[model samples]
Target: MCKAFEEWQEECIQKGEIIGALKTYKKCSFAKEETLKNIITDFSLSEEDAQNCMEKYW
Candidate 1:
């Protein structure tokens, strides 16, 4: 579920695990665009950054 993914991401960050957080984000199957947008906004990342992350992970 989305909530689980969100929690997993948070936990990964709390543990200083960027790779784990990214991997978990890649596993989320619903509303990917919305999620990417949130990531961009939250992290101040560019759309290209989001695309690159997706390409690298997925």
Candidate 2:
């Protein structure tokens, strides 16, 4: 489940809060989708992850 974290990374950079997100991602040991979602949620920000996936893939 080694998906690209580019979108999540961009989001973090845009929010100017990558420190915590990096910490959490590392803490979770980078468990793919769930951890990514956790990172998104941990920031208390909203991103349509599923929609982004669909738009990018489908």
Candidate 3:
């Protein structure tokens, strides 16, 4: 549960980042590898985090 505003903001930001990455992958024709790389690098997320997003959304 998002008990605080800060926690809610963080949750929203994470979801937004994941959705944005997927959108770019679809709309910009970024290769799968490039999208994964960008998600990790551009979003400052870990390899595991990026992979999890791919597993769920890609």
Candidate 4:
């Protein structure tokens, strides 16, 4: 599920759907530590930024 969300998020970004991607992330249920770490690395986000994203969403 995490992998699927990550791929969907990337696809949304590529299609110029930033809001959609964020909304999807906000709805994610499998965002565990490893998943969050992967998200941070995949998006080149800072740890603080990733944490903030998780906090805002989950």
Candidate 5:
């Protein structure tokens, strides 16, 4: 069986971290740009990866 990203919930897993960050942004008042910046900085994700993560998770 193939497990999905949503099924793998933990900060150690990059997928989970991205989901958590996006969910947190939705609840918080932080701006999108700031959130993206933080995601990139915190995860060391590339600009394109960060944007894609935002699109999928946000």
Candidate 6:
């Protein structure tokens, strides 16, 4: 929980690296669409989150 929060914060603050963060998150062994949904839901993010993140960072 601590680690997840920390990573989320990093992704939020480090806008230029959000795509890398998302890719890393997606590639994690623990990743799943449901988990991703939960993360986005918990953060109140949307598909724009991924798109904007990629556009800004990648």
Question: Which number leads on TM-score?
Answer: 5
Query: What C-alpha lDDT, on a 0 to 100 scale, does residue 54 get in candidate 6?
Result: 41
Q: After superposition, how far is residue 15 of candidate 4 from its true place, in Å?
A: 12
- Tens digits of per-residue lDDT for model 2, 1-58: 3346887777757555545555555576775566556646665545675335323432
Model 3 lDDT at residue 1:
56
lDDT value for model 2: 0.54
20-48 per-residue lDDT for model 3 (tens digits)? 77886968888888888988988788999
The prediction achieving the highest lDDT against the true structure is 5
Tens digits of per-residue lDDT for model 4, 1-58: 6999999987767434323445565567544576567657767778887677666554
| Overall lDDT per candidate, in order of appearance | 0.64, 0.54, 0.83, 0.63, 0.84, 0.58
Q: Rank the candidates by lDDT, best first.
A: 5, 3, 1, 4, 6, 2
Clashing residue pairs for model 6: none
Error of 4 at 46 (Å): 0.6
Candidate 1 per-residue lDDT, tens place, 1-58, comes to 6999999988667434434455566677536676667666666668997667656654
Q: Give the per-residue lDDT digits (tens) of candidate 6, residues 2-58.
A: 999999888767553444556666677444555456446555678667455545533
Q: Candidate 6 has what TM-score?
A: 0.32
Pairs that collide, model 5:
none
* Per-prediction TM-score: 0.48, 0.32, 0.73, 0.47, 0.74, 0.32
The superposed Cα distance between candidate 6 and the true structure at residue 14, in angstroms, equals: 8.9
- Clash pairs, candidate 1, are none
When summed lDDT is taken over every stretch of 10 residues in candidate 5, the lowest stretch is 1-10
Distance from true location, Cα of 58 in model 6, Å: 13
Which sections of candidate 1 miss by over 4 Å? 1-19, 26-28
- The true-structure Cα RMSD of candidate 3 reads 2.7
